[model samples]
Target chain A: MPQELFNKPVTELSGMLARGEVSAVELMRSVAERTRKVEPKVHAFNSLDEEDALAQAAASDARRAAAKASGAEVHALEGIPIGIKDVISVAGQPLTASSRMLATFVSPYDATVTTKLKAAGAICWGRLNLDEFAMGSSTENSAFGVTSNPYDLERVPGGSSGGSAASVAAGEAIASLGSDTGGSIRQPAALCNIVGLKPSYGRVSRYGLIAFASSLDQIGPFARSVDDAATVLGAISGHDRRDSTSLRMEVPDYRRGMDELRKSGRKWRLGIPKEYFGEGLDPEVGAAVQAAIAEYTKLGCEVREVSLPHTKYAVGAYYIIATAECSSNLARFDGVRYGHRSKDATDALDLYFKSRAEGFGPEVKRRIILGTYVLSSGYYDAYYLRAQKVRTLIRRDFLEAYKQVDAIVTPTSPTPAFRKGEKAANPLAMYLNDIYTIGVNLAGLPGISIPCGFTGGGLPIGLQIIGQPFKETELLAVARSYEERNDWRNRFPTL
Target chain B: MPKPEDFNLDHVANLARINLTAEEKTRFSSQLGDVLTYIAQLNEVNVDGVEPTAHAFPVVNVWADDVAEAGLPVEDALRNAPEKRDNMFVVPKVVE
Candidate 1:
């Protein structure tokens, strides 16, 4: 079978577009057709505008022609179609965040990352679904609908970036963007068998990203290959004055740096955190990650056992900190300004109460209440403050480990994608799904989930590579080393 | 450490300004109890002499030039408003 244009990575698609071998419109049509075919079963997108995508592609083609005539340099991502998770504003597009609260809301301006992608000449494609306000581990929490694992329709696409990961895995888009607050991006990418890179906190601007947990939230990319992820990361990263937390450091040429590092044949000192491979880890997933570590050992990299003692406390701290931030961030969703309003409201205060009651889903409400409680007067010191102090310990654990290792390798998720509704009833059970991935967020480190191997059941398993703060260059190179030696990136879902 | 059984669903919900249905209140009370119990494990860790990390890499004292820049036009800003009148969001009467 011929490789469809939709499945090609951004790196390859860019070369094709530059060579005039394939038109941007042709790629857009291929992606649109693929999305239309599989979207019913995958349910990865909340909304897509094919006509608008085609128009954007046409404009890209026109720019390419002009650049050719004028002997001007073309952007690296010119004409590539990338999906936007619904939480990020795309100016005039629906920014629902997969919640009923913003069911009818449209963004009035572009997110900083959106502006960056557009400037790179990429087509801002579909509005992908996510857990409402990015509060859950599975896409099932999304008010729009659950996004299914392309590998098995009965299973979930790990979330709250489930739609972003699913869309790429299903060839619905070349790549997509997702927000990672407590493993939203990496978990989904692991479940979907793709590469998801969560840059260090403040590495990517969060100016237009709908706040989930203000401190933990960082926007990242989901792509089929590590190289493509690098391409997307380069375009979207850097300082944005609009986002006060955005790092002011210079953005490196990641692809170039990755290539240079690869050529240098640098021997990486990889850490295997003992806590990550412990109880609750599926045997199959464990074997796959161990095999990946063995592969690193064979490649002449030093493998050492490192300890992140605070690992066990990550979930507890994350829920407290994230929910507390979310409770504050989501306060803007009251019916007073925009989003769904309660016609049943009688007075001003009643409006805030009823409108929120009607607009938010059960999980969102649960989180808000929990968050409010933690920040409430008496419990503040016990919960919120204690969580913050634990967070410091968590960050310190990683910093201590990095002293002995170039990067830490672990399982991206405890298990492969679970059957839909398996843990939906138990929020605590679902929270454990992100156990291995959340500590990276707490430490503000760059982490990538790449396909390591698959289970006997044919479900994909991910090997996570956690790098030092602001060290994405080394991280991508490390991930790329594993990717180059493995055939996992070549396989795709039959659906 | 606060126990899960002590979680006041009604009080918290009221503080959050969300009117949970009877069913939601019942379901969340139990569901969140499990979560709160899980969160209680944090108390086990000794945080003595540890400074709370509000942000992983806190960028302190971020200042921008105090110059007026372009703001969103009123029409565009009010575009998503559930109720709008003359380029302003119309909310339920608060003063009355």
Candidate 2:
């Protein structure tokens, strides 16, 4: 049986395009048709421009033809379709961060990642929905509307990159880009039963990513396979002069590196952090992760127990630091320059208050208020400063464990996708969804979540692999080892 | 550390430049109190001389060359402005 082009991975699609098996236009139409079929049910995209996507595909076909005629090399991602999270800017596209704040705004310049993707000859697909300002664990916080989990419409897809994950799982996209502040990318990928990678901070440029906890946020990929993720990562992982924080380091050919590592037959030292397996983790999710570890041992890998003592404080520390950064970064959305402007204001001061109150959703307002309180006079040291110091402790904990382990393994999320609105009313409960993944952001390390198995209820379970800083190549290789041995990556939601 | 009960919601809303309805104030005051109480657990960590980490891998003093390059055109720069006049964003009256 022939696989549907819409559901095929990037590696397969790229190969077909190179071999003249399919034109880029046909591939785009297949994906666009799939998106139209599933988007009404999944609501994965905030908006899409299929016409524009087809045009880009036509251009890719032309480029490939020219390359074939001249015997020139074509880029790895040529003719592939990739979705963009709403928070990342794509010039001439709607830049709504799933919020009314920028509901009417359009970007005038491409994000660094967007530019790189286009340069690699990929068609930038749609503006995928997210939690407004990427603040919540579920897409319920989005002002646009909730994006349903492709696996189960009643449950959330996990957020704030929920749509990014759901689209790929539903065959609406071949691959997608998402930004992880806490666990936006990995958590959603876990729930959707896909592969998501959060690159180490500074490893990827954040030039056009809407600031959300700037110190921790990193743009990453969500794909059907680890190999697909490596291809996307290689295109977007280089340093940019526009973003000073981007690391000035050499970008390796991650796909080639994965092959090299596999050929070397090297076994990795895997760490199982005891803190991640404690109370509150769903029993099935724990069993799946543990089974994955056992598989690693069978593959001749060394499995060890390591402790990250400061793990308990990750969520609390994350909220303080992330909110503080958000409150400051979001100040740019005032009515004066861009975003929503108040029609009910009496003066400038009144405009600021009314515009923000009207523009922001409840979660955004709650975070802004909390952030302002923490950074306010007399409370800065007690809250913000204290959290930063605690952050230091969290990073040290990962470093300490890294000395004994090549990579750490844990459940990507505590539970499978929960029913929509289950933890919506309580912010603290929602924040706990990122408990296992947030420490990686604090420690500035790369982490990848790969589908390990499914729950008895048929929901997916993800196994997270934490890698050393600036070591995504090794991380993807480690994740591929399990992926190659498992059939989980082959399954997709029947949308 | 200040008690979570002592959190001044109205004052914080004012600082954040966001208006809250009476209902919102009441709801948020209680909810945020729970979050703050949870955060109070940070005091349990012994950080006698530990330094704070603003960024996990800090890159200090990044300098670009003293050179000129094209920037966003005025038209593009003001493209998203809610209200604009002659390529400048228009805002509410400030001076009397």
Candidate 3:
């Protein structure tokens, strides 16, 4: 079994494949076996197209062999395996936003992100489960089932990218791609104890990713190492004609930044946001994060108190903007033009009502109602308009704070992964879970959560590094410095 | 803070196009109402005269040209609908 391949970084695996240490088919099976062994406990997949994945792997191997034979340059991602979030499109594969409405639906074409991955020689191993349509904080809203936290089976892995996070955390996949809209990726990364990066909003294309909040959604990587994350981001980051919002600039060589940091002795200025480590945080997790910060200080980096006054308004602004976009984006699924329609209906109105009624889950319905309420004609001036105003203020606050500081720090989550039903009973508690991370998404800056420490219960705590827009390289430098000092990459949950 | 009782479950259900029993409505109303009230605390923030932002960082005119490049064929697009009756998306006729 190539299962030893499971623990290697994606770059190492890619190098092994090129050197014939293991074939693509061999690596694919190794991951498949691991997925089979651990997925029942993790509940990470919405759909696992094993046959397709292996076939793609075989093709990638053939291409690499052919390229090597011909002395031609091979695709950097040859034979690499990636887990796609359910929210991203995978051609000829099911693209259920985890909603029952799209339960049986398959995407006709690949999203721009998928296209890039395929072109770069990576194989899409499976579709990870997510909160239906990327709505909820936990994968509990998944039409299929909730993904249990790998750290503790009965607890939730933070979501709606929970499956993506858990899959990577549990070694189901070497790397998985997830979309972050208001902390979807970072929060789950914290809970699952993986490195999750929310790229600057336009750093990656949003064309193929199902819209959660159009403005905030950005595709990013969840991997075990900072370099692995950088490698995958390099493969997927580029401009696309399909997504107008895709950045026009050339993708920076994020790996090169690592070399620069190494040469410069890895010194970084850390900014600890006084606003973040306030009262509501779990003290154990707070100690872990502060400990991580203290290491940065001891390493010759200055730690200063930075204030982001408007950090308070992020969740509020995010919900309103995200909801309004969701309200508009989801309007197309009115049983008239889409995947699910009511079985029996006397009229069109009844059909629209019954179809949506039966298809959407409680959370989806809740977000839809909230979005509709905010965007509805009469109340738009009050709710939607006001939220937009607050959104601006949130962005300005981040810009203002970044001027005084190089990067802002936060506890990736307020608490460690909680029991499955612990906060399931209350939506507010669930939203509060994302408080530390959402502000970054609201400001459209890049943020990453790397496991810094652990709780007494053994769950991991994440240290967040928030950077100015497109400063992913800098953010990862800080993360890598800490990761090197006290490597959390080798830490594993005893399943 | 947002009003909890003001959200009759009927309004939420109607807006969301969901069928709800009285018990479900009662449960969801309190649940959703609590969620909204917590979220509404942002209003007290003195965002007065401060412009509300729609996207993070700076993005200007990030739209593609309106020219038709290429897209999936309609046949492929319709492949996922659980039910489709015509070239167009067909639903129960409600216009009378």
Model 1 global lDDT (CA atoms, 0 to 1): 0.93
Residue B42 lDDT in candidate 1: 87
Ranking the candidates on DockQ from highest down gives 1, 2, 3
| lDDT digits (tens) for residues A171-220 of candidate 3 | 88889999888788888898888899988878898887888788888999
Q: What does candidate 1's lDDT look like per residue over B1-96, in tens digits?
A: 788888888999999999987888778988998898888888789999999999999989999999999898888888888998877888878894
Give the whole-model CA lDDT for all candidates, comma-separated. Answer: 0.93, 0.94, 0.82
Model 1 per-residue lDDT tens digits across residues A1-495: 257899888888999999999999999999999999999999999999999999999999999999999999998789999999999999989999899999999999999999999999999999999999998988999999899999999999999999999999999999999999999999999999999999999999999999989999999999989999999999999999999999899999999999999899899999999999899999999999999999999999999999999999999999999999999999998897789999999888999999999999988988889999999998999999999999999999999998899999999999999999999899999998989999999889999999998999999999999999999999999999989998887789988
TM-score of 1: 0.99
Instruction: Give the TM-score (0 to 1) of chain B in model 3.
Output: 0.72
User: Of models 1 and 3, which has the larger TM-score?
Assistant: 1
DockQ of each: 0.89, 0.88, 0.60
- Candidate 1: give the clashing pairs: none
Q: Evaluate residue A32 in candidate 2 and report its C-alpha lDDT on the 0 to 100 scale.
A: 98
lDDT of 2 by residue, A1-495 (tens): 246998899988889999999999999999999998989999999999999999999999999999999999998789999999999999999999999999998999999999999999999999999999999888899999999999999999999999999999999999999999999999999999999999999988999899978999999999999999999999999889899899899999999998999999999999999999999999999999999999999999999999999999999999999999999999887888889999989999999999999999999999998988899999999999999999999999999999999999999999999999899988889998899999999999999999999999999999999999888999999999999999887777776
Backbone clashes in each candidate structure, one number apiece? 0, 0, 8
Off by over 4 Å in 2: none
